[model samples]
Every structure is written in structure tokens, then in C-alpha cells.
Target: MALSWDDEPTTAAPAAAAGNPEASAADVAKRVNADDKRIINAKTDVNQLVPFKYKWAWDKYLAGCANHWMPQEVNMQRDIELWKNPNGLTED
Candidate 1:
């Protein structure tokens, strides 16, 4: 049977009160790995998993890596932009 969104595994809820921050990281990592496997096995497409509100943002992210664009090119562009404007603030 297919899994529903609620059936997806997740990290344990954060402690009701703050105590140990590093304590839960391992448990959280295991949960994340399991959830990732579930997603990969399902072969769900990005448009289906991502919410409509954020789909455009996801599309833009994908577009940057599409075609012949490589990680180094993307990083270089970002570095150049940063160097041009050190105070990386945009009017958003």
C-alpha cells in the first residue's frame, strides 16, 4: 500500500523543554535517512511533493542546475556577486 503524508517518518518532536541539543541529533539523522529512503523508493516527482506555494521557488532552484550549469559555475557566480556587493542585502 502507498504511504500517506502522515505515514512518513520524522524526527521525534523536540523536547517540551530545552535540555540537550546534541542528544537528539543521531536519532534525528536516523529518522531523516528512513524518510529519505521512503521518498526515493516511491519515486515521487518534485511537483507532487512540494507545496504549490513553494513550487516556483523549487523550479527556480532546478533551473540553475539544468543544461550545462555545474556546481563550480554556480558557486563562482555566487562568489562574484558576493564580492561585488559585500553586504549581500536585496530589496525583497
Candidate 2:
């Protein structure tokens, strides 16, 4: 009846799991925690904006989209003509 350093415990942590197993299970079964979120391919709802885990990242993405240059703003007629006739442009 002596225990060694490599011996495995035959019992659980008494104080932590004493009589609140139901409470602990409830806590675990709650909504997806922020720590469990990921940048891509997350198990939680990706479209959920209210309880966002990375608020700063979402804001940055919105800012970038707002400040982006749209293709409609540029007149591509000249470029298209030049593309059809590549003789005027240099090879480089």
C-alpha cells in the first residue's frame, strides 16, 4: 500500500467534482465558448455577428470593404482596346 510517482489515481479530484457534477455539465453544454472559435472552418455558427469572438477582426474587415475601390469606378474601354491590340505596348 504504497504509491509511486508514476502511479495513476484511482479517484477523481474530490473538491472540484464533489457534488456539483450537474452544474459542471451545464456549464460545459452551454453555447460555443469564445476560446473555441476559429478564423476559418469553425464548428460554431459562422454567420453569428452578435456574439462574435473576434470583434476587432470583424471591424477591420468591414472597414476594408468600405474603403475598397470598385471596378466600376475605373473606365476600362481604353484598356480593353489596348488589350485587343497589344502592338502599342512594350513586351515588358
Candidate 3:
């Protein structure tokens, strides 16, 4: 696209903010604590489930997501071979 003014779409300047442009640490804390919905919503970033809703389940889910690995790295080939011949498997 050309960098000419005629080629660019025009956008109006945003309306003036009503409150302080800078959000204090306390302000963030208040918003996070004021409503549980904000922190525990379907639009959670990184899909980091809310620990409040499911407690331990949420923690386990986050731990699983944090993991970055492939199934082959864990060596599941033996299990697949065994499954193909259950009769040859032993209790051990």
C-alpha cells in the first residue's frame, strides 16, 4: 500500500478520558477484587482458568498447560506394542 495520505483510511481522535490516564497499582487491585466475573470469565488470557472456580482442578489444568512436551519424548511405543498383543502381556 502506498504511504500517501489519500490511500490511508481516516480515523477520528479518541474521546478524552474521564479519569486519570495512569492506572495506579491500587486501581488494578480494586478492579480485580471488585468483581469475580472479570477474573473468572470465558475470555481469560492464556486460558489460565480461575483458581477460585474449581480450586485444585484449575491448578492441575494450569500445570498441564505449562508443560511443553511431545508424547514420543515419554516413550509410549512399548505401550502401543503391548496393546496390539494383550495376550502376551503380563501382570507386571
The residue-level lDDT of candidate 3 at 35 comes to 29
- Candidate 1 accuracy as TM-score: 0.24
Query: Considering summed lDDT, which 10 consecutive residues are worst modelled in model 3?
Result: 33-42
Residue runs of model 2 more than 4 Å from their true location after superposition: 1-45, 48-61
TM per candidate comes to 0.24, 0.30, 0.24
Q: Going through the candidates in order, what is the number of backbone clashes in each?
A: 0, 0, 0
Any idea how many clashes model 2 has?
0
- Model 2 lDDT per residue over 13-80, tens place: 34436488887787668687453444443455555665546989888878877898888988899988
Q: For residues 58-79, write the lDDT of model 1, one tens digit per residue.
A: 8876776475566655558766
lDDT of 2: 0.67
CA shift of 84, model 2, Å: 1.2
Q: What is the alpha-carbon lDDT for the whole of candidate 1? A: 0.60
For model 3 the local lDDT of residue 8 reads: 52
Kindly list the per-residue Cα lDDT of model 3 for residues 41-79, writing each as its tens digit: 334544354655767887887788778787857988778
